[model samples]
Target: MTVDNIYDVVIVGSGAAGLTAAITAKKNGLSVVVLEKAPVFGGTTAFSGGVAWIPGNPHFQDRPDAEGGTRVDRAAVHDYMRHEAGNKYDAAFVDAYLDYGPKMLRFMERETEVEFTPSLYPDYHPEAPGGAQIGRSVTAAAYDGRRLGKEFKRLRQPLKTITFMGMMFNSSNNDLKHFFNFTRSPVSAAYVAKRLAVHIAHLARYGRGVQLTSGNALAARLAKSALDLGIEIVTEAPVAELLHQDGRVGGVVASIDGQRREIRAARGVVLAAGGFARDLARIKALYPHVREGGEHFTPVPEGNTGDGIALGERAGGHLSQGLPNSAAWMPVSKVPFPGGAIAFPHLVDRYKPGFIMVNPAGRRFVNESHSYHDVGAAMIETCRGLGRTEAWLIADHRTIRKYGIGFVKPYPMPLGPHIRNGYLRRGKTIQDLARQIGVDPETLAKEVETYNDSARRGEDRQFGRGSSAFNRYLGDANHKPNPNVAPVENGPFYALHIVMGDLGTFPGLVTDTQARVLDGDGTPIPGLYAAGNDAASIMGGAYPGAGITIGPAMTFGYVAGLSLAGRIADHRAGQAAE
Candidate 1:
């Protein structure tokens, strides 16, 4: 019956979407507070690649060069979305996203600590209608965690599997290139040495690296902006239920610092609490692999357990269903660490030369260099009747040492640890490797031989590995005719078992163009809005390009803030005239 505090807006979640909404609302003359269930504030965004796929981003449009300088056409972007989403495409939502996504980016960069650099990442399906080979994706610029002062400690750390000694690398290939060429190139050696020295100093001073990159940098920048605007970001606050009365959502009852308190929102409540990817029961019902008795692991924060969706449902919102896919699928392998194991999404290694993915039967099913989503979908469908949605990544000693596989790093980093931990399997010959991995020797040998035949000729007769622009983008350009094709003929082959995983869920609470949560009858639940993974993906279960999820999440979050602010402004204007 007693209320603890109140604000014009209350945002559930502190990821890119929630912080974006808070920043926008505050800038638009509304008092806002962000509540995060996790002790940390970044949600899954901090652990992500920090890239956003904005079709007409101002950064790319301002410059035209051979890399990604082509002007983005709105019509073309729309056509591409239509082709990617197929029947699930919602024109109203798509229009809103396309119209506001760029504006959102501009606003954040101009008004906050946000900054972006155009990326060379291509559309997942660059050959699709209206798809561009480049100029659509942009990643957050690297930021210094020192800017956040004390709040930097609360920022979620980057995925450990991808970092070295808690030191994160930029998503740009340039940073990795320097490390990869450190031994061969003198210039790179000095660069790596300097980077390592700086990282060591940062570790000593901050107990973690202060040079933030990727999603961590994005999260830090956003948090700094929110704090600078005098917004309250309350962590360890989990919403228990929505305060619904008079046919509208007004506030929330949340456990804050061990006390259940009522916090009313005079204007609206925005839900951006990641997604339901970790909600086992709900995923088992929605995810086909889980329903069919397969394991699913996610690298996102465990705090994202469909809290936003559940809260929306309690406030008369319904989840969107019947999408082709329920989540953004990715192939992940378990990397044995100190305690147990961690989910490591195979984002980089597969595209390198001399790597191939084979099912349990030792047959190649898909082009290993394809997008992670495509490869994951293929893996799921290939293993549908096999009871487990899984596959194995095979590589020769040369390739394994040159590029590494899964969480195992390149040469100079001993493979003994991985081999001892049973995370990696090795064999001196093809037949020997097959036996170690539980595959029939003859079948495995024949598959390798068949693949080598085409690989030697710089072609994939069966699966067209390096045929697409997107595939080649991730491939080693220094390699021969086919960057993604090479013989796996070297002895001492290595194999890692990979299974189905996801970046985030796609099926979420149904919402309108304004990001308003919708009821079963397609009516907006007043004062309740959804953004980020809490809102059904505008891409409609399809991963169109890099940063597809983050891009739209931010756009809709901006929309939700604008919607609430606009409505209040209109009401006040009418009253003032009276």
Candidate 2:
């Protein structure tokens, strides 16, 4: 038994969760190493919007008008959580998260290079009790990847489908609006020009854009912090098995550079490996649509294949059961490539005006402006009733040119390539588009007519499209009457094939409040912890807001690190005493 190395903590996965745990553990006077199966770090987080739904964050503490302002009411937050989690609400876990989440945010910004700015996003269901229209979600500040020096290449880049010529845009909506209106507004044009110049310069020097934004920036900042703390991030190292000895998980057996190596952990091993989104067999069993023999696509890193979950289950950790949904549902459209297609999540385009999603019958099923999860769930149920598994996002020529649909860019970007490649379907009229998309011409025409009647009046009486703050946040604020409601009476029309997908899995390894992986009987497994998508989501499989996935991930990572360092109890005692 040749032991290659030993550390106080071994974090499996290098996404936001693992890197956060590594930094926290190291800062608490423990040696930590991060093992990532992929050639690069970041996991699915690198491809995300990079926002965290962190209530009571300190960013706007002094601003009374802000959501995170002095008026932050803990009881209201608790009520919202209870409403969101419903039957799956675990009071202890939720309370721990609420107590420690803000602390973690403050610590990361103060003690490390990671920084965040308050976002203007609202709660997905602000109409719910105790929900606020703003002040909860925060986005990672854009970071210069050049600061990482030689290791910059190891940081995963944003999804190529979302980036323009390899340049990532900020997820705060400001950069996107500027680019969208560049041709019409001089101020926006100037901003776009400056941004393009910087991106071009970066490409010439770095072979990739070094001005990282969104989740890529978050990943880079965390990686830099971990590296500065002397934490070892071993990429291309896949943990094959858990090291269980004396009723405790001590370390892992990882394949590093095609060589097997045994690395031991003195305190514990934290399972922060991405999730089971790509794990075919597991997802087939857990995901409703997949189990029904429907197609599912995901844009997450392919390296996430349930490695952590399998390792934990093998070591006697319990897999949580009976969540309403198994993953953070996302509606995605396949973008045509050279040889195949890639899943592009419909994140921003759905909320824009002059567009509506329809079923095979050409009828609008769900509110297109709703959160991705709610829309996805509705999509699944709608398709199930129709005995099929697909939907179409219908848009007019004017709308498509203004907001763009799916992978197709707005005006001047040239939609010819997408149309020719069959990634986009277009027609000269409403009836022509219905035929092009395999729907009844008369039915689609009638549906469009009915929608336009209400749209012209700035109302969605059927589904209440623009009835919430969250819906309007992603919409064009300059639009008249209602930002999300506009008559689609233009000549030419287009349609995009939509399918089911996910941001990440929800139901995961069952763990206690301290992040200790629990056995089937709810007994804690010694020296074993889980965070990130590897652990069961605290939101109980519900989509609460913009950053629900990453928010709890980071908070639990902080908790797990504290537990590994034997400081969690002391901290809890201090908090209780306070």
Instruction: List the lowest-lDDT window of 10 residues for candidate 1.
Output: 569-578
Regions more than 4 Å wrong, model 2: 1-4, 62-71, 385-387, 570-578
Which parts of model 1 have CA positions greater than 4 angstroms off?
1-4, 62-71, 567-578
Top TM-score prediction, candidate number:
2
lDDT of each: 0.88, 0.88
TM-score to true structure, per model: 0.96, 0.97
- How accurate locally is residue 528 in candidate 2, as Cα lDDT from 0 to 100? 92
Error of 1 at 133 (Å): 0.9
Displacement of residue 282 (Cα, Å) in model 1 is: 0.7
Provide the lDDT at 9 for model 2.
94
TM-score of 1: 0.96
